[model samples]
Target: MLQMNDKKLYNDWAAKTSDSVMKRRPEINTKWEYEDGVVLQGMELVFNKTGDKKYLEYMMKSMDLFVDENGNIPKYSSNEFNIDHINNGKVLLALYEHTEDERYKKAADLLRSQLTNHPRTSEGAFWHKEIYPYQIWLDGLYMGSVFYARYIKEFGEEAEFEDVMKQFTLSYKHTRDEETGLLHHAWDEKREQPWCDKETGLSKHYWARSIGWYVMAIVDVLDYIPESYEGRDVLLNMLEETVEAMMNYQDKETGVWYQIVNQQERKGNYLESSGSAMMLYAIAKGVRKNYLSQDWFEKAEHIYKGIIDEFILTTKDGLVNVNKICQVAGLGGKDKRDGSFAYYISEPIVTNDHKGVGPFILASAEMEMLYEERK
Candidate 1:
């Protein structure tokens, strides 16, 4: 039986998260290109829960700082055409639908414009980035497909649906391991990157958050993709495969996933917050959507409980802090990330990190909804 303390814990954490965002305007600095998208996702979740006009206003104001009267995003570059950059389009679409803002529409169209010119492999997958040539990270699927689904829904683009299908089909064909039902972190189409596996085009290791992004992408995009489309079944299968593979790696003791998901026996590898939250969101939503059996909901609930108990912290001033979020993981680079167990653990962990926060809010939202429904 749940105690009063458990309820208080949830309420207190939610309130602190809301207060923290409300108290400060997220910085408009140029440190990283995706900062606005991350902040907007957080604000969107907050607004959804609180119905606070200020949260919406905050998101619009920050977006307006970069997007001009003509809808040009100040720091965005079409030449690069990286899929990660497309995430902000979701926020632009939201603002456009809610407010009928022309600037937001224009900004979204600018992102769409990149899709038109971006390079694709022969099988039609968008290369993860121009610099990374022939590589498609599981991370890129979420970054790009969510926006792809949104654009197809908003603009009535039937052709885009085919492209969306192709992206996932190509990704699964290249990255999925038949034996384990798990996806590799990336597939290097060129097979030249040192981390690339010569025969499979897969990277040397799997990273939890990378697959988490892919899982979240499929579930979220499925919401927008037309059910009648033949490709929808392929996506559903892919999502099932992802959940099945992920379930195998869940830590039996903690109900969370390892940073290097399959590396359970590796010394010092620990349960990670962002990936755990992503899996919880995936499983809960998968059950909610009937893509998976209701039994998965039990797994989702168990993991969410574990996350709150294990990763969540209350700061001295009452801020809800999510600890032990691995900073970032990736394949070959000048930095020599070997995609090994040691490399995964070497990444720094931080408190209340946005990577964990957005996913945690998403997981909490789904869990709260499920709990309310069961009650």
Candidate 2:
């Protein structure tokens, strides 16, 4: 198989997504959401890499629709504490640093304000959302802590640093399953939710994307956590253990992960692209940051090649598709997610999904740099 050019693939994906959504540009989905944030963060990384103002323009355009001249995000309510909403906060510091606009800072501060009083477990972790009370989802760590760590880094909130680090520490302590070394999807302290295991307070099975979210969370959040911090190495070691555990479950043939990661033999289990891409990003970035070793980079190289062959494909119609992405999954909402292995594999698979594409873009951005340096 021909080698995939990381830069070209990422650029093409972004252009295709931008064109598809052009009809709604100035009026883009201004929800301040995870999906939009994921894609735009990819765009932001690309912009950072290429120094092309176009990517910046795209991000600002969408943000402008929601942010007034004064920088109040209209629909955002910190009161509810939905971690999904915090995903967009990742891009704010980049915008503020480049533009030095008070609005960006104000907007970021608005998001950060939520952390101060956000509801938490008695042990001091933010609830995934208000509605999902007394619960912590692996997904929530990426969505919330990455921004929290970054805000502390930017604005010099030294006192809050320990709290930010503690969240990751506590999450690691609670969710990790020693037998498999894979953390479960979510944990309910009360264990009242239908999905949580009554004894362990952990969710039923290891959902790959939650692990993916978590791996990415630790790496990205580490960028803001000072290396000298007393607890940093503890988290770093935990990160290594988690990544190694996850790699052990990778399908030997497909090089991708399963929707229900641990049980490869289970019926309806299948290779999933988005989580695969996310793992690729986390591994590549972690290696790049020296949190992991040279061997891990080699491992990332192998996984990236696997992702290309398994998930990156050009359709007969000429659209390049990132295939096999699990569409959506959650626990205990209007339509209750039972958190079963079946519930995981049953989520509709999609192609070129923004969630998949976003991290793929970031992974590619890192790999592309590695590629260029090798040349």
Candidate 3:
């Protein structure tokens, strides 16, 4: 599989860390940046694997930078209820489990508080943003649902499970294409957005990373969703359908998914890292949970190997590099993102990017666990 030496690769990946958690800020300090959560998620796995407490301490200290002794997060507003903001809840949950810290619990509760007041459509789908009215994005599902499911499980909030189910079902109902079984990037309920189709609630075309987010969310949330819940089977079926649909678009040569999943022939549409890692995680976990056949696991293993060989770079400094990460994807906005093949390819690709690195670390952790189980 990964020809690069394992010890050397580990050393390289570990070298990327900074000495103090408080010192880790984005090189280009932009709001809504992806760096902290990405590093924390990756570090969580690394710590679990190696039992190195420094990584865990780094995560706790970094989170402490945002959270105060009183358990309130600094510079965070719950009124916005943007699902992207909830991603860090995973770290909180981990901290609570490991350290039994009340501060982490309070910080997670703050995120849960947003769910009570967050705007939702009549069908129970969360709006992607307050400013972007009546829109449900594929990206939002992974962002919020994983945290929601974990919260519900941790606190015995069984009643909220229905809301979780409704979120996925409504999003799929609006965005799923009947013919291709692929989902659009976002759906505008008002159909007022220029990117939205008049007849269907769908955005332009199937975006690979968007679908990847949904796939990863479904599989992850299923872990905590009670097996007896009526809607649980529905989610499993959705995951199965999504897995089948995704397999059709995977490049046979590279064993990785493309930027625009269905449009491989179009110029500049290359294989992407985040989506590939997400798909690998979903498929491997699906098979582990017995929701999918063993055949899918073989495919996931193949793709995982492909990612290591093609996308990952081992720098001289011994840090792992995730190359060819699409910076961002979106629908209607001030900028024109038509969701065309060319538009998808036009996004800048960066090395050692956090977007891809977090998911890659997660996928690798799962694969390593599976290998251990088999052994």
Candidate 4:
């Protein structure tokens, strides 16, 4: 039941993601970075839905290259206090379930162990990373909490549920902007970071991708949260409110959101593919999981169509490319990123970046499944 465009774009991108790793892209191997985590996870989505052995084989081979016989993940130092590293741990659970290799379990355990000691704000939110002390980036919520929630569920560590939910609840409480109903990119508990608003302690504007990360985190984490858990309501409600806010800003003509979400009319602001893809995935998955209204079905369709019609271009060789992807976006990195509206729009836009391609694949998988269900 996959749409024609879904089959074309996702199939092309799936091959591209695996081919990139098979070639050992510099950023991809053994490193615990979430950017690669998402791509691997997206490959799993395709494998799960289509029963494609190659997709799963590619994912497993990539992990096997990095995770060793003793379940040790090379180049991953637990001392970094980086929640980004937690994202790859998501692949471990599925690998263990499929192969029942205790090494996968032990590998997952190592990642779960990091959450035990990861630093947190006074309000109990995790700092995005060690270097980003006292700040909670929306990016970290997806990177950390989805793995944390899944591990606790899979391992029967029910006691950790409350702590896991607190991260989501507190993030919404701290970062939400009532006027826009959009959460800021990150929140600085100390309000001392160069990007913070002295009075509000929140980043200056809503970057589409950051909000995309927050929404994707909850939708993914919700897969493991018990329906009876009251905290599930909190996460669902946040998803609803935030998506409602974001839909108001959707480009009326294109159905995609701007890089700086609130500045839709700004001269430099352009519609971004990765964030649009993430938003589509979140909405489609939310509706599929019954976490959001059925009305979101139409919204998801529009966004998906927008990405296909606006972002994807077919190459001369028939390979499809996803364009307008933000090459990178972060704060307080090596060069010192100033989290500003201008800073966001200035990032390079490229074709078929993992950030865009992975989410596009996941979103397509969700939409395909939804279409099958409705049929």
The RMSD of every model to the true structure, in order and in angstroms, is: 2.1, 2.7, 3.2, 2.7
TM-score of each: 0.93, 0.92, 0.90, 0.93
Q: What is the C-alpha lDDT of each candidate?
A: 0.79, 0.80, 0.78, 0.83
* Candidate 4 residue lDDT tens string, 1-375: 224465543344445544444454533554456676788788788778767787677767767877889999877888899898888898888888778989889989889889989999998999998999999999889999999999889886676899989999889889999887999999899988888898888888889999999999989989988888878888888999988999999997778999999888889999999999899899989999898878788778778778888997766655557799999998867878898777887788898777887787778778778767875
Clashing pairs in 4: none
Error of 1 at 117 (Å): 0.8
Model 4 CA lDDT for position 42:
83
Error of 1 at 174 (Å): 1.0
Which residue ranges in model 4 land beyond 4 Å of their true spot?
Answer: 1-30
Clash totals in order: 0, 0, 2, 0
- Steric clash count of candidate 4: 0
- Greater lDDT among 2 and 3 belongs to 2
State the lDDT of candidate 3 residue by residue for 227-303, as single tens digits: 88889889999999998998899999778989888989887788898889888878877877787887676687678
Sort every candidate by lDDT, greatest first.
4, 2, 1, 3
Off by over 4 Å in 3: 1-35
* Candidate with more favorable, higher lDDT: 2 or 4: 4
Put down candidate 2 lDDT per residue, 214-297, tens digits, no spaces: 988888888888877777887788889998999899987766788888888888898888888889888878777788886776
